[model samples]
Target chain A: MNTGASSTRRRHSGRIVTALLFIAPWALGFLLLVLYPFAASLYWSFCEYDLLSPPRFVGGANYRRLAHELLNGEGFGRAVWNTAYYAVASVVLSVLAGVGLAVMLSWKVRGQAIYRAIFFLPSVVPTVAAAVLWMWLLDPGGGLVNHWLTAVGLPAPNWFKGVQEALWPPDWWSGRAAFGSKDALVLMSVWGVGNFMIIYLAALGDIPKSLYEAAALDGAGNLRRFWHITLPNLSPVIFFNIVMGVIQAVQAFTQVYLVSEGRGAPAESTLMLSLHIFLAAFQNLEMGYASAIAWMLFVVLLAATAALFHSSRYWVHYQGGSP
Target chain B: MIHDKATFRAHLLLLSAAVLFAAPLVWMLVSAVKPAGQLTQDPYSFWPREWRWQNFADAAAAMPFFRYMRNSLLLAGGTVVGSLFSCTLAAYGFARLRWPGRDLVFGLLIATMLLPWHVTMIPRFLLIKELGLYNSLAALIAPTFLGDAFSIFLLRQFFRTIPEELSEAARLDGLTEWGVCWRIVAPLSKPALLTVGLFQFIAAWNDFSGPMLYLSDPKKFPLAYGLEQFVSSYSDQTHLLLAAAVMFTLPILVLFFIAQKSFMKGVSTTGLKA
Candidate 1:
């Protein structure tokens, strides 16, 4: 009996040792990469470090500057609006377009795989390549889009050069039709919404065909069946993509950097939050201020996620039960 | 049979959407082969006025295109090895073993996914610099060697789906835990492993920011960043620019065709499960 107990304890210790050995790599990563950086960033948000000198305690000065900019519609304010416009518009538009395309792809049809390949190909196109492609396509004077528009005798906005927002033209837009950099970026993102469309199509497959059959038996037409059966089943995925899309858009950097000449040029019209943080830290070496902006973004994201989850209860219907 | 009128309308709408979605790519191909000066000229023809296949050669000559591609492959290959090595071990630990605080630590891993990269970007960069890894491919690849949470999560999910009896049977047959991980569990999870590798490879390949951040030396610039150099200076040479973009995109497109199943599985399983 004594030997058995000792052996059992020994085996238990062996299991613990094995688990530890297995997890060492990730634990190291979590500490060095995630945990330490997280704590350091929070602490630096209050300091005034310039990467060349030691950090000096500034005690809310950076936050105060953020608040001032936020209130005045200046530096940080512009980024907030740019990020909000791009994130909200792109995610919302992608969900709508994704669901529509997904439904179309889900149709019982020929060449389905070919159609899927065509759509999915864009999302996988390298961002640099895509950004360059769009830049030329939407070029103001000699590009394809404007060429076609001018051929049809319509107006073509100076896409990368223009500063006007399409949907909510600012007071400065002044009764002119113009598509700006952010507008172009949003269109570019929607063009790549094929990835999310793939997800929605997958979710659409999980929906029971019986639901649609029952709707049809009740004399419901195609649109009605889609409205009732398809939309509800897809709500969960839509919500998930919305959350992810917002996060992606918030961190969207490369395209914004490339298109706006690394400084959000063309009058800083595309000065997104990520680029703003990049320029502040790396470009100007204002590490503390950049950390402050990053913290602000984190808080906003947490709040946004919480709010979405709160709101999701009403709309996102899980199949088995409520989330 | 399905209604003929509705079917025709559906096909038309779908075909038009396909055309619209594929427009940029088609335009890339068409513009790539257009004669050099013709792009800046009088008439805009949809098809190339002359098939200047020479534009592709010129684009490659205009930049260190092959060198950039080799660097890209190196980064992608290095990240895949690192992620697979670290993540597979971590996943088996989480999935197969009972350890105190395991669940809590796994929770932290998942939460790390949502923490925006911007929050940690500066410190992480500084960390690399302090480690004397800045401006090297290792600066990007080394951290991936530590492990990625998303890959770990995917792998853990797959490892959990694997029956515990297999691990137990291996143990009884005298395999150690590490032996079981490598010899038994790892072999069975090849598809899951491939999915994770594909994700990281695509990520490292398409990454504009990583190469932009860590690698400043033009000699080390991957295609993604190296190609952008053309955008700033030589964008006026639209044919060469388009040709380069097409070439940059072609391999990944072909890779997608080859591994479409793995790619589709990774996206769908992660999305649906989340």
Candidate 2:
């Protein structure tokens, strides 16, 4: 009995050592890549440093400039508002569209696989390439869309050039209509909604045939079944998708960067916070300021995730709650 | 017969939606050949009055297309091998090993998924710089080799689905733990390993940010990053730009076409289903 117990302990210790060895690489990378930089960034956020000079710690100066001088005077608040607007609107629109399409596709439909492949094609398109494609597609005047619109006696708005116009034009939009305020970015983003659509489709597939069958037998119609059985069942996936979407949206750099030609222009209408951070860091060489913005973004993402998790308790239905 | 009619209606609806979804891709292909004037004059027109086959050749010539392809293929290929080796090894530890803090460590990996990439981006860039890997393909490939938490977690979940008896049988036959994992478990994980490889291939191929951050020489750029040259170049040639975009997209599109069903099946079986 004593020998068996000692052997068991020895085996357990060996397993522990092996496990540690397995995780060591990731743990080292995480510390060096993620944890250390995070701490260093926070330190730099309070300092005044370019790459050339030693960082000078100036307590509250960076924060104050970012908050008071910048936010109040130069419409930094508007940029914040724009990011939030884009993030929330894109998440809501994409999620709804994704879920709706997934449901539509989930029906015992023909060519289902083909439909999925088609929708998912855009998701696989490289970001830079897709952005280039959209720049031509969404060109304000004399583009394909405008050409069609005018041919049909409709007005065409200058997509990239125009600002201060409604994103989606009304029925009365005519030749006098103006282009929207960086709404072209929004329009292009919707095309890539295929990513979330895949996730939702997967979730929809997992909604168990029995649940839908039971609902049908109980005289629930399609919409009714969707609401009670499907929606509730899909809540966790929805929650996951939303959080991921929000994170991605906040880091919306490549599209905006390439689209605006890295100027974040069209009256700075498309200057997403991520691009703003990039410009500050790389372009302007304001590494400290950019670090500050990076930290701010970190805080915002943390808050958004916390809020989602806090609210998830009310909505997201796990098989067994609070595991 | 009625059931058939309903199925037929569903097919029609599915086809219509698929057409709508595929419209942009079709537009992309058509626009690539479109005359510059026709592009602006009739953007929605599917039929290009003038075909510009040279546009693809020109796009290819504008950059080191072959070089970029080699770099992308190498980066993606290395990422697949690295992710498979590391993720499977780590996942085995999580799935089968008995250890203190096993769950805790796995939880840490999962939590890292929620930490925004922006939070880690600059730090990772700095780490790569400090490691003296910057400007080398090693920079692009090494970070990927560290293994993604999501991929590890995914393989771990798949690993858990295998019965414990398999591993026990190997142990009874005098196989060491590592040997059991290699000889027994690895063979049983073909579907998952393929899925992880496919996902890594697509991701590493599409990634513009990593190469953009690290590589400086345009020749060293991956196809995705190399294609950015057309946009930033001093040319207003929309035809050439579209052609370049088409060139960059074709491999990934073809890849997706080949592995898409398996990829979709894998996703459905995994966390996406959760």
Candidate 3:
């Protein structure tokens, strides 16, 4: 018995040493790549250093500038409002679209794989390339969209060029503006809902066929069945996607950066907060200010995620039990 | 009768939605084949007046397409092999090995997932510079070659689902721990390996930021980053840009076509796990 116990202990020790060896590279990378940067950003957030200069601590000056000085001035409030609008709207729309697509695809149909392949195709296109493609599509003068509009007895609005007209088109011909403004950002975001579609598709498959049959016998209509059985089953996935989507949306950069020609122009409508941070850090070379912005964004994300989890208990359902 | 009607309605809705979803890509393909002047002149048209098949040839000629293809393949291939090996080793340790502070270490690994890449962008760039691996395919492939927290977590969960008896049987045959891992465990975990490989390949293939940040040499750039170069210079040249974009995405398109069954299965299974 004593020998068995000794052998067990020896085995654990051996495993521990081997585990250490296997994890060493990642641990080293975490230190050099992650931990150091995280701590450095925290420290640098308080300073007022350009990239060229040695950082000097100024104690909340950067934060104060962001809150008080910058907020008081031009386009800052507009940017805050615009980014929040874009992030929140995009997340909600994309989730709806994704779930809707998944539900539609879940039905027994011919060529489901073909549809899946087609839907999934656009996402494989690199974001930079996608942006370039869209820029041509949305071009104001002599673009296909505008050309079609004019050909069909409609006025073509200058998209991505006219700020006020882009956002809220004057109600002359049509009462509703279909596209343009920062809405293009939301539209662009929806185009890449393929990942979310795949997630929802998986979740949809997990819903037992028997549940639907039972619901059918109970005289639950398609809409009712979806609301009663499908919605609750999918709530967990919905919550997860929401949290991830919001986090990703808030940090949205590449699309806006590539699309708006690095200016965030047509009245700074497309400058997301992360793009703001990038402009501050790289373009303006205000490393310290960017650090402050990043920390603030990080805190916002953490708080938002926590709030989502807190609220999820009320709506999100699980099959087994809540954690 | 109502059930049949409902089914018909469902099929119709799905067909319309699928067409709408696929419209953008269809437009992209059409734009690629259209003449440059016509593209700028008619950007959103479904059908082009004049088809310019040579636009692809021209775009290919303008860029070092073959070289970029080779670089992307090597980078993505290297990333797949390295990540599979390193991540599998780490995951095996996490899933199977019993040790002090194992939970704590695993928690730290999960925490690493939330550490945004944007935050470490500059510092990682500095580290790569220090290593003198900048301006080569090494820069594109090396940072990711080590391991990823996400991939490790995914594979660890998979390894955990596997039966322990297989390893014990291999051990009884006088196989070392590593031997059991290789000889028994890997062969049995084809699904998980395919999942990891497909994801890593897609990610490494679509990766633009890594190459954009590290590679100064155009010849060393991957297709994604190479396409970005054309975007900067030829934003107005819609046809050429679309042609280049189409060329950049063709590999992934081909990959998906070839591995469609396995890829969807892998993704869906992993989605459930996540």
Candidate 4:
């Protein structure tokens, strides 16, 4: 009995050694890359630390400036509105477009593989290349989109160059700048909804066909069956997508930086929070201010995510329990 | 008859959407070979009046195309090696073992995925510079060798699906934990490992800001950043720009075509499970 207990203790210690050895890479990374950076950024948010000099304590000044900009709708304020608008608009549109495409692709067709390949091909193109291609396509003068619009006798807006918005045009809104830079970016994003479509397509396959058959026997039409049967079953997936879409949309940077030439040109119209943070820290050397803005954005994201979870109870139906 | 009509409508909707999505790529290909003068004179022409295939030669010659290609390949290959090495080990630990605080640590890993990169961008850059890695590709590639949260999670999920009986049998045969992880678990998890490598490769390939931040020397620029420079200088020569863009984008498309099954599987599994 005594020997068995000692052997058990020895075995437990062996497992410990093995576990530590295996996990050391991520453990060290967590300490250096994640833990230290997290604490340092939090502390630096309260200090004036440019890269060249030691950090000096500057309590609340950066936050004050962010607040001032938020009210005046300048630096951070304009970015806040732009980020909000883009995140909401892009998520909603991609959901609609992705689901629409997924539903269509799920139908039994002659060339299903061909159609799926074609739809997924565009997304495989790298973002920088995609941005460059879209830039030429959406150019206000002599571009393919504008050329077609003019050919159809519709107004051609200066995309990537114009500051006007289609959703909330200002009082001085002219028909000329009907669609603007953010609108153009949103259109470009929807073009690459292939990832979302693939996910939704997979989920659509998992829905039991028997449910549809029963619904049809109960005198349900196609639209009714889709609304009552398809959507409820798919709500959990849609919710997952909404959460991921928001996070990705918030982190969206490369395309925004590319189209705006890194300065949010044409009246700061494309200045997203991510790009704003980039320019502030790297370009202007305002590390303290950038850190503070990052903290604020982080807090806002956490809050928005919490709100989404809170509201999801009313809508998201998990057939098997919490996903 | 009704089902036939519905199917026809679905085909019509799908065909129309495909045309809309495919038009930009088709335009890029056609634009790449257009006579340089036709762009300014007849920019709206749907097709090139004459295919000046010379534009492809011009695009390749106008920049250090081969040099940039080499840099891109090096960067992408380095990341694939680094991430696969680290993520597989960490995943085996998390999936196949039981230790105190293990579940808590795994939860922390999941939480870290939601923390936006901007929050850590500044200090991380400073950390790299402090390590004397500024203006070096190591600054970009070294951190990936440590581990990535998303890949680790994906791999951990895959490892858990592996049978524990194999690992136990290996242990009975005097295999150490490292041997079990690398020999038994890693080989069995090749598809997931390939998925992780594919993902890291694509990310390193698409990464614009990393090179933009850390790399300043023109000699070190990858194709993604180099092509941007090409655009700035030769913005007027749309033919050359389009040709270069097409060339830059082709490798990724070809890779996707070759790995389409695994690539689609990776995406769907991550999406559905998450």
The per-model DockQ list reads 0.66, 0.51, 0.49, 0.67
* Better model by DockQ: candidate 1 vs candidate 3: 1
In model 3, residue pairs whose N, Cα or C atoms come closer than 3 Å (at least 3 residues apart or on different chains), thus clashing, are A144-B43, A144-B44
Question: What is the total number of backbone clashes in candidate 2?
Answer: 3
Candidate number achieving the greatest DockQ relative to the actual structure: 4
Q: Give one digit per residue, the lDDT tens place, for model 1 in A1-323.
A: 99999999998888789899898998899899888999998989999999898889899999999999999988899999999999988988999898989999999888889898898888888889999999888989778899888888877888887887886645435646578888899999999887788899999999998998888889998889888889889999899999988888888998899889898878889999999999999989999999999999999999999999999999988888994
Q: Which portions of model 2 show Cα errors greater than 4 Å?
A: A1-7, A73-78, A152-154, A165-182, A208-220, A317-323, B1-16, B35-44, B266-274
* Candidate scoring better on DockQ of 1 and 4: 4
lDDT of 3: 0.77
The reply for model 1, stretches above 4 Å from the true place, is: A169-177, B272-274
Better of 3 and 4 by TM-score: 4
Judged by DockQ cut-offs, the docking class of candidate 4 is medium
iRMS for model 1? 2.3
Tens digits of per-residue lDDT, candidate 2, A1-323, equal 99999999998888788877776667766677777887888888888877778789988787877797355745345457667767876788788878877887888755677677777677778788888877776676556667676788876777777654453344234545555545676666667787678878877777788987888899998789878988988898889889888888887877877877676677777777887777777778776777887878878898989999999999888865655
Residue range B1-274, candidate 3, lDDT tens digits: 9879887987788778877777777888887898877755545557878888999999888888888888889988998988888788778778877778989989998887665565666556667787899888887666564678878887888888889988888788899878876677777777788878888888888776678678888878888778777778876666788888888877777887887776666655544211
Q: Per-residue lDDT tens digits of candidate 4, residues B89-136? A: 889889999988899999999999888889999999999889999988
lDDT agreement of model 1 with the native: 0.89
